[model samples]
Target chain A: MTFLSGLTPYFIAVFCVLVVGFWIQLQREKKPEEPTGETVSTSKARRWVDQDLQDDTEIPAKNDEDDDDDDHGSELDLPHVPYAPPRYPVASMLERSQDFYSLMNQRRSVRFISPEPVPREVIDNVIRTAGTAPSGAHTEPWTFVVVSDPDTKHEIRTIVEDEEEVNYRQRMGNKWVKDLARIRTTWVKEYLDVAPYLLLIFKQTYGIASGGKRKTHYYNEISVSVSCGILLAALQNVGLVTVTSTPLNCGPRLRVLLQRPANEKLLMLLPVGYPSHDATVPDLKRKPVEDIMVHI
Target chain B: MTFLSGLTPYFIAVFCVLVVGFWIQLQREKKPEEPTGETVSTSKARRWVDQDLQDDTEIPAKNDEDDDDDDHGSELDLPHVPYAPPRYPVASMLERSQDFYSLMNQRRSVRFISPEPVPREVIDNVIRTAGTAPSGAHTEPWTFVVVSDPDTKHEIRTIVEDEEEVNYRQRMGNKWVKDLARIRTTWVKEYLDVAPYLLLIFKQTYGIASGGKRKTHYYNEISVSVSCGILLAALQNVGLVTVTSTPLNCGPRLRVLLQRPANEKLLMLLPVGYPSHDATVPDLKRKPVEDIMVHI
Candidate 1:
């Protein structure tokens, strides 16, 4: 009876602590108000282009500057990210373990690709594959935009080039340029148009509604990175070659061109398709396991 | 001749920049001889006992102090973190993508066990499975330390409990304690001894040698997290049930007990085995797909 009494306080203390923790978590869920820096009209005006160009010249000059906040137009009201636990048969774990080992060993990063156009179903299946990644508070703060239209691709290419020109010529200084020197990358912007599919990854830095306030995401960077990893693995698994292209200059330009909302920020541009028949990569080697692992 | 004349200057400029970048990168790789203000010895001594006790008691504590860098082992020489282009084939990509998706869907955070002993070969295969995670510069910065021996498991349990005790008693404030309420986690070291295998994940924060100077690793957090994800998936694929355990106080305690060399930091303690017959999880649901994905 005495031992039970002593343990009672500890149990009660634990229970009380847990209840309070749950309440605090619930309170943390309340969204913050919309940021009041730039007006809606000005923001939209900045991204709106005149949409005038010749067939051979599909580039949209970076000149649109509009601030319109009321245009929700088919804007995706994406819900919180999902965190579904897997359901596997316990009996087959050993066999599955062997299969996973072999599969992982065979896994590699693909740069060179065949020039064959990928089927739409294959792309859809890959996206579906990415849907399984776990996220913070189950808020899978990610968006995957697929672009296949030739005209849109040309427009994207043009805007991206305009941005890249600025980055390469002015924004990216000596250090940045030097770091990227070995990659043999150029702001040619041909891949944006040549690749059969352009998949744009957007990170939801903040969430906003038509009139509702904004919500803050916890561990946003970590959450997004994890999702990206899963997405990359999925794309690779399906036999599609992906080149992760970042629109360092073209985000705002493309936003106006694509009419993206204010809350969504661009993260990566993945051009997915067959690699050019003669595509070649730099000769690189991976660090040995001993250099990376420690057994303590 | 005209084309060659035009490209000559550009090539010269590129060559100059590459030489400078390599020099700078090599300079950055050198480690500082003097220690930072934080001393590892003091912090380790302080938490050593508390860690042992917390494991036996199974109390949930949050010791924020132990999270300090100095408490980890000796700092090692970190390699240059490189951003390289991926390489892989297109056809094999689709097959792997479907397999990963299926594997992910089958994953679960398991805590129950069946008391059945797992074979050494199975454990070896599972660890090998985790070795396949993609890493920055292909560094693969990870270590899997398996503990099945009765003595080692007991020692680990004691070390973990001591730290957890302090966390629940005084170190963890009411708010922090409350947040972890939903998950019924305790510091009981039983899982270490009871489970058939206890896999300790130690992340090489930097690189160190027997006598050579230490090296630095870039994006260490992101690198380790990806490795952990791959490890989790690998374990699941093999048919083993795992509980991803984070010891609030064991970081310093385990470093000392295991006599791990400087440079390695404990990341997670994963207990692996078959589920107990009546293992039950909290009736929690994942966030919706719409909430996680956004289109721009």
Candidate 2:
């Protein structure tokens, strides 16, 4: 009886310590799950083959590690300079619009790129025209890798073709219950090896400002894509042909093969040259302006 | 003793039911937190003014529901047709390339738009030119809503300015701890009211095919952005000036106001017209060709 009474305080102290420890442990486990609790039930569906194009660099929480923003940021408090772009008379403007539309409307994605070598200076000029496109905050966040080397092009073909086959095989396991022969043809990218110039476009996910700190290139993807549109226009004006392709799962390998820095990512790959004599395009019709534009 | 023994079976049965219920509850709670656990740590940072620009239509789990995709899917078989864009002589190609580059280099994001009424037909042709841009799987997922109605333009300005202020306030709470006075001037979007035409660009995240089933538009956002690039080029070709602005937090409100369907999210907004007489621009320089391009 005497020993039991003496040990009561010690037993109570141990009990209190155990309770405090458990409460702290419970708290530590509960923090992360709280903010994300409401998010689960809403994300019912998953992504298909479009996994490579998701660039969310601003978002560290990611998928396939391809998160990057569009190309640019503008300078703060830069001196404003007097500017006036040439204003065309209504008649000239009308004439120019019709002419530009006629030229662009004739442009099509041609896969049969001729092996004939193109002028490097002309290619440079096309890229220079592309660089003139506007970017987020004026951040010109694009890199044009003009690959003319035969061995390098072949290596790119190997990497891209391998990944493409894997993508087809993965799709085959899941939802793609189609004719395997027809689908297999899509996996073989012969143009990668045949083209005179392989234009591999990349977007700088972020930029290095002074002191080596990371500067955000907001809207980098859109800015780069827009630049690509101008490049296409320039190509059409100069009578060149190329097809736009986003190689499935080939970004990382191609990035490594090209020895590009981590800050850059593959956006589009264009095999550029004159079209083959037997060049062909998919028989598709574009929706007219009435179908695409709404006026108020 | 007999009565107590008789109640033991019932008590055991009740205990078993309680244990099973708790096990099921634990399982339900435990899931959903698993697939998303590694993701929480990386997403510590958040998007700022760029939040409105995050058009992730594919990711249904979203902020303000502006999330979408760059799009389209292809049919099993589309017939091919012979295609050969006009081929120019080398001298003509060089001259064309140089002329195009010179023209594109003059293009800038002009903010001060004159209120003079431009011809509607020119705008139509520009939109038509934009529609000609290549999209993911040929999905031309773009909508250019041209607002000339003074009332609607004013209403748009109000919505946009209000949201811009809110965005500013939200940034005020966060890391935008510099030059509030200078930044305040940017939020006052007078051009929205003064421009003859306001072009609102939307990327159709998914398309409605037969039977109202959603058809996936692969790379819809990128595709639409590319189209906008072409539209910009077209505008430049016609000597029209405009400023591209992504209204912060004004997407949903503007989407509802513009009566764009649920599948369409705003990608860009351009107030198009001639430059105001006292027009000025930031004296900015783009990276030279050597810096932006690499040869392998």
Could you give the CAPRI-style class of model 2? incorrect
- Candidate 2 per-residue C-alpha lDDT over A76-180 given as tens digits, one digit per residue, 9 for 90 to 100: 334455567888999999999999999999999888889998999999999999999998667799999999999999999999888767655442221121222
Model 1 chain B lDDT-worst window of ten:
B51-60
- CAPRI-style class, candidate 1: incorrect
For all predictions in the order shown, the interface RMSD in Å is 16.7, 9.5
* Whole-model lDDT per candidate: 0.53, 0.74
Q: Write the per-residue lDDT of candidate 1 for residues B1-296, one digit (tens) a residue.
A: 99999878656755665576567546644633212222234333232222101111112124322223231122122222222234445455556556666776655555565567877666776666556555433445566677777788788888878776655544433322332334444456566778877888766655432444443333344455455656666665556677655565466667666666555567667888876654544334444445444333
Q: Pick the candidate with the highest DockQ.
A: 2
Error of 2 at B247 (Å): 1.5
Per-candidate DockQ values are: 0.09, 0.22
